[model samples]
Structure formats: C-alpha cells, structure tokens
Target: MKEKKSAKTYKPLQILAIGAHPDDVELCCAGTLARCIQRGDKVTIALACRGDSASMDLPGDKISSIRSREALHAARVLGAELIEMGMSDYGVDLTLQAKQVFSDVIRQTAPDVIFTHYHTDYGSDHNNTFVLVRDAALAATVGNFRTSRPAVSKSPLIYMWEPLAGYGFQPEIYVDITETFSRKVKMLNCHRSQREWFRRRGGVDFLDYIEVVAKFRGYQSGVRFAEGFIPLKNWANIGARSVLP
Candidate 1:
C-alpha cells in the first residue's frame, strides 16, 4: 500500500476537537484526528466533562475517573493530547465561568482549527458545548476577553460536527477517512465502560451504531468511510483553506 502524504505541505496546524463527553469526539471525529496524526499535524481532544453521568448506575466520581482514563487512552490511540475541562456530567451550562475555562483551553493550545458539537443537538451538554466553543473561539482572539490565559493571535476556523442521528445536521464539509476508519474504531473501543453502559442503559451496540453512522456519512461523501462537518463561517474564516477537509 502507498504511504499517505504527510501534512507537511500545509503549515503544521494545531487542531482541537472539543466535545461534551469522553466518547463524543471518538464517536464523531476520531477518524479525522487519526488522519491528522498520520499527516504529522498536532491534535488535541478536549472534553467538557469526564462523562460521569454516562452511567448513573456507578458512582459519579468513579465513573468520571474511569472515563478520564479512557479518554486519555483514546487520545494515545490517535496520537493526540487530552484536555479535561472538569465540568460536572449533565451539568454543562452557558455561564461566564464555563466560557472562561473553555477560552483558557483555546488560548493555551492556540489551535489553528477547532471541531465542536452542533448547537442543535438533542442533549443539553451537546448544545451547550457548541455555544461555549463558539463564544470562546471568538473570545480567545480578543485582547480584552479577560480569560485566564493570553488571547490567541487569531481566531481558529471553527467547525461543528454532525449531531445525533435524527437531528437536523447538514454538513458543508466531509473528510474522507477511508484509510483511518479502523483506527477510529479502535480509539472508540478504548471507552470499554461506555460500551457496557450503552448496553445496560440504552440497550444499543455503541460501536456498531457509530460505524453505521460513519458508513452513512461516507456514502454522502462518496467515500468508504468519512466524517462530516458544518463550517461556522464568519469574517475570521475568510481565505482559510488550510483548515478545510
């Protein structure tokens, strides 16, 4: 098989994928992260919380710790760094404090591109994740945002990932993940507890459902496997071609 081209053609970019919970990024954009890693780009996985509420049957703290470990393991699988924002599970709110924390992460990382949840998602955390990232992405570029860290040199290109299956998500970009799909699945499998939680609580095969979604997205993009995103277009996004898939 031919080796994939390193992402060296474009300037090395810091890419951040933020989600409401540990498994959210894995379920949505792990394939894209894996591809970025293959191409030698820097990748960071940020979760709004430790996903403690993912399984209420277990103690919250215990599940939070377990989920954090799982998130770290998944990050390793994709050669990315994991950043936990320490919000309580099912408790993500669109508050000033939350915005500050989210802004701090963006400024500290100085990412060139950000992928986050779609604001129209069913879950509150998912919807709030979108709001927080959108606001923080803007605040991170302003000198007077009053965040913990210094402002980023410029705002990054922000893109929102596909929402839950039934949500009204219309994708404007599609990343072909044909070569990285297996690794994406492997990374998602690191959340072993989530799989068990889904079965016991939701009665769903987690991996199976995600793979099906990936396949469906791939079909939309004319690829064997793919991930879809909608660009959060604005003045900052003009002429930013390096971040596009």
Candidate 2:
C-alpha cells in the first residue's frame, strides 16, 4: 500500500499591532504578541504618537525621547519591530495625511493580521487611531491611493484589542496567554517611565492593573490568562482561515 501523506504546513505570518501611545500595545496585547512570537511568527508594534504629554514634570521633547526609549525596550522584550509615526500626543486624526502615513506603514509591513484600538474607546486619540487604521487598511489595497509604498494586493484582517478597563467593549475572541503572561509583564515593565508617571499621578500600580485585567479575561475564557479581541467583521476584513496564534 502507498504511504499516507502528512498534512500540509504553512509558513510563519507577519503581524502588525498599532496603538495610540508608546505603551498602549504592551498594556493591551503584549501577551498575545508574545504568544505569536513563540510560534515563530513575526510581529511589529506601531505607535501613532510618542506620548509627549504623558509626563507632568518633563517637557514635551524630553518625555518624547524617554518614551521612545522605553518603547524600544518593550519592543525588544516582545521580539517585535517598532514603528513610530511621530504624531503629537492628542493629535491623531482622520485627516488625509494621517491616512496616507498609516497606509504607507501597512503597505511596507504587509501584515497578515492587524491589532488596533477599538472604535468606542475612551480617549479621542484612541478613537481616531481606530478610524485611521480602519481606513488605511482599506486604502492600502486601492491602487490609486498613492502612498510612499506600493499598494498591497489584499487587505489584512483587523482585530481590536480590549479597551481601557475593558470599558464599553465585549470581546468576540480570546487568546490564552497563560504561558506567555510573564513575558507580557516583562514587556510592560520596560515602560519604566509610564510606571512612575502612573504612580505619581494616579497612585496606580500599573503592573497590578494589568494583572487584574488579564485575570478577569482569563476567568471569562476559562484560561489562566488571556487577551480579548474583536474582529472587524466587514466583508473585506474577514477571512476563512484562523490566523491568531
């Protein structure tokens, strides 16, 4: 008898995660991204802003420089590439220029999956980041959009990570990050400047907050730790295959 054939194998995927501020990705989806890296997938973290206004004491330029260094450290922890858009804090908008810049990033990365902020998130910057990512993902596919990079042949699947405090948002998917939770914490810890800012301004222990959110999501999903996400279910963004790791 002829030998039976094994199942076909697929190559690793390129993932892109976008956030409004330097530590946003680490706060919401670092565990998930770490899990993806463990699976041999490539990941990129893009920040819409440098978080120049995050500090109460430091000047805009100084804080921006500090946050950039922190973000670079966090990206190294997660084994992901980092992209900074150089937009001002609270300046993310739905302008044509913003869309083109975002589109160029999408084109250059050519991601198979994208993770971004939810549309109804609390802050204006977060909400606008959602709009920009949503529009640019489509714009990147159009031949005549005219970005620095060439248009992508297909639009990538988009998933919105959980909002702040999981407010006004329900997840349609959950990724079990129990095994990678420590790595996630390490990535977040790299944002030392943000930790100090939160402690001094709000008396909040940033790491504790992250743990609580992860545990809550974990309980909901019957995992020790997990990250929640909502897919952009529009026809163009839906796909038959499961891409999350």
Top-TM-score candidate index = 2
lDDT of each: 0.87, 0.92
What pairs collide in candidate 1? none
- Tens digits of per-residue lDDT for model 1, 1-245: 99998775666789999999999999888888888887778999999987877775788899999999999999998889989999987889999999999999999899988998988988899999998888888888888989778888878888888886837887878999999999988998999999999898878887888789888988999999888988887776434585654
Candidate 2 total steric clashes: 0
lDDT of 2 by residue, 1-245 (tens): 99887986768899999999999999999999998998889999999998999998999999999999999999998889999999999899789999999999999899999999999888999999999998999999999999888899888999999888888888889999999999989988889999999999989987999899999999999999989999999977999888887
Count the clashes in each prediction: 0, 0
How much is 139 displaced in model 2, in angstroms?
0.4
Worst 10 residues of 2 by lDDT: 3-12
- List residue ranges in candidate 2 displaced over 4 A: 1-3
